[model samples]
Target chain A: MSQPASNAKPIILTGDRPTGPLHLGHFVGSLRNRVSYQDDYNQFIMLADSQALTDNMDDTNKVHRNVVEVALDYMACGIDPAKSTILIQSQIPELAELTFYYLNLVTVARLERNPTVKQEIVLRGFERDIPAGFLTYPASQAADISAFKASIVPVGEDQIPMIEQTNEIVRKFNRLVGKEILVECKAVVPEVGRLPGIDGKAKMSKSLGNVINLGASADEIKAAVKMVYTDPLHLKVSDPGHLEGNVAFIYLDAFDTDKAGVQEMKDHYTRGGLGDSVVKKRLEAVLQDMLAPIRARREELAQDKGYIMQVLKEGTMRAREVAARTTDEVKAALGLSYF
Target chain B: MSQPASNAKPIILTGDRPTGPLHLGHFVGSLRNRVSYQDDYNQFIMLADSQALTDNMDDTNKVHRNVVEVALDYMACGIDPAKSTILIQSQIPELAELTFYYLNLVTVARLERNPTVKQEIVLRGFERDIPAGFLTYPASQAADISAFKASIVPVGEDQIPMIEQTNEIVRKFNRLVGKEILVECKAVVPEVGRLPGIDGKAKMSKSLGNVINLGASADEIKAAVKMVYTDPLHLKVSDPGHLEGNVAFIYLDAFDTDKAGVQEMKDHYTRGGLGDSVVKKRLEAVLQDMLAPIRARREELAQDKGYIMQVLKEGTMRAREVAARTTDEVKAALGLSYF
Candidate 1:
């Protein structure tokens, strides 16, 4: 008898901290990619409110409301519920139990050595009194992934170490229990690293006030594009400009459809012929056109707040089912399950 | 309109790590006192399987089965379920979530500095590579107390700092949330410190091979009593014996009836008229009578293992209701509650 064919489609787990609404940076970084992956993989998109509160513990009110806003952004960005399962982290009690068990498999020093946590501590300036939640979040993330038995985790290149830590715990847990109850996930890095901000910073961030929101109005898009930073040396109509560090050209590369025309515009700018105002106007039109459909969908979603909340409520229930089943297996493997 | 009356009957929370069957040491240190508190306070007896797994993670089968065994011991010891809530720690998902939140309130340095933790580290020889779970257990204990709004935590004197840490988090959480959502707890140190082992060691422990389990057979009790440590300086029947450091006398003081006779026996032994054999026989009789009902009940309970399991299943369900409500309030205060 021939063996049954192994399931070919991979399971994908990805999420965002419900700290704010989605912006253009999120669109370019992961959300846009997630829309494409929806058809190829079984996806579980999580709103990591518990992890968000690890650092934003003082601003929980923001996290609480953003859970709905973030889910709405996902729906508006084309993460179909039929393709992706969206969930709130704290709603799944099994995740919390799994996290507690995994904490035993890792050491304090190892957590301290986690690159993502080290970078975050420096960025957040939590010198001596760092919260224990912040230090042990990698374990929490491990619980998040392993709870769904997700085989593929979409994360940035800088976050590969987090996947490493998760896989380490997965291996240790399976070895200790003598069963492969948990799945080890690999980090799927995107083709693009990160999109720069309108201010031309290395990365776009809401806290920096340089992000273009996914739901920007036409006038808002125009205003953000107008403020885009370019080479300061290109002062005159005929000045030779550098496109290497120009954010306007980068946006065009990331969003514009007329690649040949955009390249021609870039060459003209470098040859000291294209005026700065003329190039800015071209970039503005491309960005506005690219943002039009997304803005339309966001506005449509915004009109029905009740429907958006329903999506979250339903998704959270669905998520809890998968989470509960996974936790049952995990606790059974650990011999901690009473029922 | 008057203010809501403060809840008067002080709430008492206590538990045992279900690593093994309850022994004579547990009876003297806490269980005996719990039997009395049932009438005067709102009491909760938790079977701490999650905490036991911190050190016994490899022996989960033992931990899982012992949860019921310990609960049976409580029932046999007259810890009335009608007066006290008997629950399992791992079954309460809210406790895990509350522990996750409290982890942020405590610092790594502060956990390392806890005197009881330091002493345990030395005792266990976990110099540098202590499991993160063991390191964070005080925070977990804090969650256990605060989850029930427990006002009186019955612990040994050595555990005073743990209660202090719990109160610290309670105060900090209330101050940070700008609401009195958590209540500070007071430690109820029992009148006695600890019961020494049959070998006359400082403490009775399962690994130490000196414990007299509550369910020991009569012959086993006789054998254990025969091995009781006495003053070696008194070699003959007429030789004077010292009673100050005798562990047998301490056990008698804590467990035996006929205190006047026990005191007379102590004086007789020290006055060089009584021998170790007479004292040993008397101690054996008192212990046998004390444990007779407990052993009988334990045997009857052991005959129907399913019945014991049912008790825990029902208790855990009841415990989760209270825990869920408390966790909701806690998450709301921290701003992490998505609902």
Candidate 2:
């Protein structure tokens, strides 16, 4: 996160949780948007390993190792570290301190009312035993957004509630301080957000294990395409297939550039002659073509983890300074600066 | 917050919320014990301004100014800054980071079930609108205790649950790490752990405004003694008085050095030959004698606020080093260290 030195670009804050390696779903949903925003906006891409530990506390070593994996995936997916600051959340202690103060501005009931947090708790099956971190992550998210004074956050439809919660905290903080020191961020919902998983889950989350990683090998990609959810009624080559809810067609729609060819296949499949294996072959070919270079780049970047860490170190050092300034302003507003 | 040398002194973690000046109740409850322990125990006395803002978010400036007032009270009451590390909570960012990780180990249901927090929510009339910080403060307190690896925590009967919560978090972290990196602390409940307010409200607290501050002027102490809750049935000079729950008698019992003389006065009051005015005169005298030197010392210290801040700065700088080491260990335990 750089200073706003006469640059009119609004800061964009977005990142992955680093629970695992990046996936096709991540590519279409956020990584691609991050790449697009890197040049036009002052981008701060975060590897949110600490936030990932809220539910993954059982496997912290995994979180530790995935920082590099996510960083590698970001680089492989065209997120230029020079243009977008790629920071590790755990390295920036100011965010935690910022969250400590922001926590007082929001009520426990408000956090419970956050639709995104509620959905997350339910998804994690933490019903009555929700970790305090999970419930208060929205405040932490708000701290991340306000620490950089980010005015734009790229998120999917399900995460719109998170943006609302961040703005609420911003408004409450400003109202308490009697000044607008924190900027409210708006969600940049991409047109191709929320890519369904290969197994047809609503979202491709790590916990569900239904995802195909961006670094998936050709064999793994082939297996995933064969297992892609499609119409069960059309078992024979002569039987007509329904296009609705077909994961293969959805993948083609999202990734394939040959629109007319895909349309021809959809028509043939809808009529009564296209075999399921034929459609699977086309989907697998498209996915292989898309992920082969990314896989190669990821392997190449993975060779030297030291360079990945150095990039994170430099980014975090710069981000630490920006976040420290924001925290100082917040403390001054609260009259908490003792010295 | 000093390093544990070959001296082999068990560490004590204790502190006060810098909401206001220390009162007579504070002197009797914990401040006296803190002074006594400074010689033999490795003590870290914290001014918990961050925790104070949990419910007092609107009056942050009060919490800020009172950090010095509390430090003054600490010094005035014989807590030597040379022996005790008197640090400010907000100055140690490591504690906040430690608390961020500790929050993942505690559950929302567990925090909700804390008896002290429940009582505080009811006392503050924050039934449904409890601040998230207020609810999560036990986690923060655990952070404070574990950050020092403190084995002794000076608390009252009301705070036994807090000690229990701290130990629970410690055990959870140890269990997750498969080793006991965090030591559980035992609560040292002083003999005079709690003192009744002047209004006989069972407890003297800043929010209740029923306290006679240690820095109270002679006239203020006298007025407070005059308003002290006494036996209402013994209004006449010839009526017998009940000493139980009588705050005037309680103060005399706690502060008066001449035990035989106090017993003589109690006998006369029980035998229907003493007036409330007469007993109040003696209680006022006892309070005045006890508070005179403390008030003078507090006044002397108040003249140089810079010295008080300097004490905090030096103490906090030392404390920051200790806590940073602890946080580094915790992060290492969680395998979150990147560089």
Candidate 3:
């Protein structure tokens, strides 16, 4: 579905917390989708090192190094520097200023009510002594979007509340200041909210030990595919098998181009004829085809790490100009313009 | 009493909120004292427009204009650009970054317990809807001090809690980061916490209609002196009078250089021999002597407003270098340095 013609080309801001390298789940869920939006919208792919350090404060050296790794992953996954502006969060001071301004628009009570933050706090087990930075990240995210004048934010269903918070700040800022200083943003919920892990877990994550990196080699991909979860009930080669909970079928549904052939295989498995080994081999072939070009691109770019860093530096410089101009307008709206 | 090292002058960080022009209370309590500190220690005076906008967000135009006014006030009051670094707060984005980092070092509960903020909330009558900026200002103040590695912070006795809050953050940051990344600032409480209003009120403020502007002309000064409060019980010239609660004596104690003469006059008045008019005339002469050169310098500087702005711009640029360097060191310590 597309928006109305009167609506501007939705400016999109989507990024990853650079805790580690991007993985296959990220490819299917967001990164690959972002590559498609590059020519269609004003895109900003950020390396959120500052946000990552909110939880990884004690291990900031890891965060610092991962910023480059994540940027490389974005390039390897087909996010174009010519179309999409990739920025390091720590390099743009305007984002920090915008965050400070938006902090006033939110309350402690309202921040505590954020559903995503609430769940993450529980998941992270920071019940009593939660880091203030982690709690206020939603406000910081609002700043990131509003700083770029981003009108469309691509996020999962779990992150819809973050968009709500951003729009709330936009409305409040405009109303309080008697001007449309900030643009309201919409949440674009992706078709697939999450991709399951190789272990058949509900989510793919670094901590889960099931994520396959975007830059994984062909051999590595094969090994990972070998461990892909299949039906536990099926014992014999000719045994009637269920394909519903089989992770191999899920991967086929998400990544395969020939859906009809995949459906036929699934039906054959359920009809008491096909074996799990044949299905696993076909699923592995489809995944390899999907990741082959990406892996090649990652390898080509990884040869000269300096070139990747240069791309980031150039993108950051371009991003900073836009950010600075937006900050000036914001400061003007707030009557903070000095000259 | 002085510090242990007699040759070592205390480093001071003091500033105005830049909401309005410096008035008589500001002149007597802080501005006059800042002039002398230029010769003694490393003095960093700031025009705190960002902090001013916490409460005055609606009046940003005023804050923007008053930044120059406050800077001019500093220069006119003899805060030498050669000896003191005068800067604007919002111009330095590093302060915002430091504030963000310092927020992690402080707790919401600890911020809520700040007595100064509590009193301010009551005074501002923002009981439940206290702006988050207002609540977190102590942390921002910590950034302001720690950004400069300020060793002495000149403040009133009522602001002791704010100093304590800054030191707490300093200690916490050092402990958590495992490095002495911040410096602890001592509060240099002035002998006179505040100057009483002309009407003998406990404090002089712009809202109280008792302030005399530092830029007041001779006629304005003469007219303001006439309103100075004296002993109400001394109905006749010969009647013995009380001087303890008198506003005129407070000003004399704070401003007058002829302490022996002023003491003798106070004794005469208490012994039922001196007239209130005589003491008032003496106080007027002493104030005019103190204010005459400042007013003349202000008049001279006002004619060349461009020159004053240039001074401010130059000082702001110099101050930014220090702040930027300090911020780089801070980011490096936090391992957020992109470079």
Candidate 1 segments whose C-alpha is farther than 4 A from its true place: A1-8, B1-8, B337-339
Residue-by-residue lDDT tens digits, candidate 1, B172-282: 888889888888889988788788999888889899999999999999999999888888787998998988667678778887878999999988888897988888888
Candidates 1 and 3 compared: the better one by DockQ is 1
- Tens digits of lDDT, candidate 1, A132-216: 8888989899999988888899898889999999999999998999887888888999897798999999889999999998878
TM-scores, chain A, per candidate: 0.96, 0.96, 0.95
- TM-score of each candidate's B chain against the true B chain: 0.96, 0.96, 0.94
User: Chain A TM-score of model 1 versus the true structure?
Assistant: 0.96
| Best lDDT among the predictions, by candidate number | 2
Ranking by lDDT: 2, 1, 3
lDDT of 3 by residue, B1-339 (tens): 213266755567889898888888898778878887888788889898888888887677888889877777788888889899888888878888788777776766778789999999899987777777788889889988888878999898889999999999888777767877677889988776789889888888888888878887878888888999999998898888898888788788888988998899889888897888888888888888878888888878888978877777787788778788878877887777765
- Model 3 misplaced stretches (Cα beyond 4 Å): A1-10, A218-223, A226-245, A271-275, B1-11, B175-181, B218-223, B232-239, B273-275
Q: iRMS of candidate 3, one decimal?
A: 1.8
Sort by DockQ, top down from the best: 2, 1, 3
Recovery fraction of native interface contacts for candidate 3: 0.35
Top candidate (DockQ) = 2
Q: Is candidate 2 or candidate 3 better by TM-score?
A: 2
Q: Candidate order by TM-score, highest to lowest?
A: 1, 2, 3
| Residue B24, model 2: Cα distance from true site in angstroms | 0.6
Per-candidate fnat, comma-separated: 0.61, 0.80, 0.35
Q: What's candidate 2's i-RMS value?
A: 0.8
Interface RMSD of each: 1.4, 0.8, 1.8
